[model samples]
Target chain A: MQFWIVQSLNSLALGGLLFLLATGFSLIFGLMRIANLTHGALFMLGAYVGVTTLKFVPNLWLAALIAGLLVALFGGLLERSILRRLAGNALGQVLVTLGVSFIVADFCLIVWGGDPIPIAAPTSLQRPIVVGNIAFPAYRLVVLGIAIITAIALHLLMERTRLGAMIRAGVDDMQMARAVGVPVSRLFTTVFCLGAALAGAGGVIAGPIMSAYPGLDADMLPLALIVVILGGVGSLLGAFVGSFVIAIIYTFGSALLPDLAYVILFLPMIVVIAFRPRGLFGRRST
Target chain B: MSAAARIVLVLVLVAFPLIGGDFYINLASQIFIAALFATSLNLLVGYGGLVSLGHAAWIGLAAYTSAWLYLHLGLRHWITAPLALVNTTLIAGLFGWIALRATGLGFLMITLALSQVLWGTAYRWAAVTNGDNGLSGLTRPAPFGISLDGPAAFYYFSLTVTIVAVWMMARLVNSPFGAALRGSRDESRRMSALGHNVWLVRWLTFVYSGFWGAVAGLLFVYYHKYIHPTALSLTSSAEVLLGVIAGGAGTIAGPIVGAAIVLILKNYVSAYLDRWNMLLGAVFVVIVIFMPDGIVPGIRRWSARLRKT
Candidate 1:
């Protein structure tokens, strides 16, 4: 019973990080109708920033905040300059972002070096609490708590706010939203930065567990893609549900299959997609 | 553009091995193989209007099959070549059936997930695949009782195969089936209304591209004499994708030109600086932003302008 509970917590911890990343990815995909491949690189960039910040200030929260802010700014610039110009050209957007990601990844490699650098949790959260027979790390619990709070916060922001309404409207129909006096150009920049910030925040928060690595972009991209697809593109609830499903599968699949874990990981998505081509929560495209 | 000009181009390419030294011959052989791979990818992106990000999976599958056959079963090149095509076509059929259910982004993600499945298998199945360290020491086979041990002989062999394949692809693109595929890409609803089976066209294109991709893989393994999981990686897929976009999509020869430019840059630039990916990324950005039609169409436009002037 204790082992299963601890494993479930592990799954939640992984799911939490995935939730943060995929929510942003889905939002961007919903609005732009383009796959922002550079979002993965932003996640990597966030982790690197966290690593650098930790060297100066020993606080995890501060380091994560700094990392998130830095990447958000970068994301804003990318949106304003590059993405805005490309507009409706999906292929062009993909290639441009891909190119940006390559440069960013290489720069990270040059600065941080190739070795995986672990970002240590704060001294306060480093300790483990006894749960039944198992000792679960306090930081992992903290991560789970943060994820729940963020999910709720995102839900409220999207549900109650005028900005959220505009975003939703834009996702439904960009030209319609624009014609109705919604400043979609500015909105695009805001949403993109917001999404980037979330991914960066997820990176910093999960950095201690996964560690900052060179190829983290490549590693996390498929997971994020799986989550967004399973949950439904642009739906926060879908992203949340998808994250848990994938996290549980990953946690258990790694334990069960070990070597064939990725294959196991892919199977559920394939099955899900075969049945629901638009994804579990995806809105059908006209 | 004339038949005479086309014949001359082919003759020059066929005779390249005679004038070029061993190094040039090897480099040209790699270019030809890359061209074949990119051309196959173009069959989807250019002709079928599907941008599959995981096309390298088929190529990698065939290469690994050839390597495994050579290592474990001692199967000769002649036997393995046909087997690789069958392997690729079967997998393509299965994956395409599932993936083609969704269009656009969903399709791209499904293809990516499928490739990762193969990548995981290659990484995990250590006893058979030799895992990440990769399988090496597969020698060049004597196809039709002719030894391709030397660089020149192998180059000629590769050239013959690539030319034949490209010609077949040209024929395919001009056929009635190809017209339907193109029509579907431009206006699927209209095509369907006109009695064309859009889904079947896309499926057949996917399978056809997979077959040619497998052929490219056979050439790749034969030339390099090794196979690794990296061939199945997202990076390899992206490289072929970049070639298709940079060369200009919706054109038959565009991807081949795109592949040549990219491979040349990779080979020549890496020799100078270790940050070739950075340079390549910047180049890609420039191309996408300014020359969205890619190098081939961009050149064509410029030449057309010069003639008018």
Candidate 2:
């Protein structure tokens, strides 16, 4: 029973990290209709940037903020410059993002070399907390707390703010949103920035667990894709539930059935997609 | 292409090895295999309008099956090769039925996810696959009593297989089924309305492409005598797709040219440069920006306009 509790906590930690990476990916896909393959690369770039920031300012939270801002600026440029040029060519746009990702991945390798860089967790969260005859890793609990806070914050922004309302309109119908003077072109840039910032911040948070590595982008990209596919695009509830479910499946699968882990992982995905091509909670395409 | 041009191209291919020595012979062999592989992918991307990112699954599956059988069970290449091709094709049919459930971006994601699953399986299933250390040292077969142990001899053998494969594919694309496949690519609703069974068309195309991909895998292992998880990796699938698109997805000869350009950049240029991936990425971006339809079609359009002017 205790072992199961420990595993469940680990799964929750991973699911929280996934939410940060995938929420942005889902939003970008929902609004722009582009899969935004470069989001994974952005996540990896954020970790490296956060590591560099830690050198100047030892505060992990500050480093994460700086990393998020820088990554957002870069992502905005990418949207305005390259992806904007391939308007209406969906496949071409996807390919361009792929090209940029390849470039980013190679540059990361060139700059950081191939080894994984492990970032130390904050000192306060290093100890394990005991509760009800079981010990829980404090870092994991903090991660869950952070995820819940971000979730609540995002909910408030979407439900209570005018900017969130406009973004929601755009997700529902870009043409109608434009007709109502929503400034969609600028909105595109803004949403792209927000999504990139989330991924970058998530990257810094994941550093203590995953580390910055050469193939991290490749490793994370598929998981995010699965999350988006399993969860409906632009649905926060869907992303939340989907992330936890997938995280639990992956964590327990590796522990229990190490050899057939992936086979088990992808089989349900294929079955679900065969039945529900639009995802369980996904809305009709605009 | 004109008849005279085709004849001259074949003649040059036949004569070049005589003058180029072992290094060029080996390089040329690699290109032929890649060209064949890229062409197989084009059957889906070009004719059927499906961009399958897991196409390497077939190639890797066939190669590993054949190599592992010979290594562990003492099976001969002659037997394992055909068995490998059949097994891969059957599996492709099943995967295609599942993947074709979604069209456009959904199809692309499903294919990518499925391939990732296979890649994970290959990396983690240590006892059977040896877990990424890879299986190596397979014996090359002698066909028609001719030894293929020599690089130049194998080059000629590969050239024959590539020619035959391309010829068959050309016939396939010109057939009634090819027309139906193309119809579905441009208009699925209309084809369904016309009683075409678009699903069957795509499923068959996927299986046919997988069979040809397995053929290329046999040649790949014959040439390299090695197999690894990287053989069926997402990167490998992406590289083949890149070659197909860059050459001209729908054109027959376009993939050949595109595959050559990509392989040379990957093999020849990488030898001299430390950052070939960045160079390749830049090439992808440039091609998308300047020549969206790819080299052959782009040149054809320009020349047509030139003639009109």
Q: In candidate 2 chain B, where is summed lDDT lowest over 10 consecutive residues?
A: B101-110
User: Per-residue lDDT tens digits of candidate 2, residues A1-286?
Assistant: 9979888999899899888888898888888888788888999999998888888988878888999999999999999999999877878887788888889989999988899998878888778899999988788878888888888888788889998898889889889999989988888899999999998988888887788998888777878878877877887766777788778888788888898888787865776677776676778521
Q: Judging by TM-score against the true structure, name the best candidate.
A: 1
A33, model 2: CA deviation in Å?
Answer: 0.7
TM-score of 2: 0.96
Check candidate 1 and list the clashing pairs.
Answer: none
Candidate 2 per-residue lDDT over residues B165-284, each given as its tens digit: 988998899999999999999999999999999999999999999999999999998888988998877678878888999999999989999999999889867788888778777888
Candidate 2, chain A: TM-score?
A: 0.96
Candidate 1 lDDT over residue span A156-274, tens digit each: 98989999999999988888999999998888888999999988878899898999998898878888988987888889998999999999998888877777778788777778777
* TM-score of each model's chain B: 0.96, 0.97
- Overall lDDT per candidate, in order of appearance: 0.87, 0.86
What's the distance in Å from true for residue A71, model 2? 1.2
Per-residue lDDT value at B3 in model 1? 100
Model 2: how far residue A181 lies from native, Å: 2.3
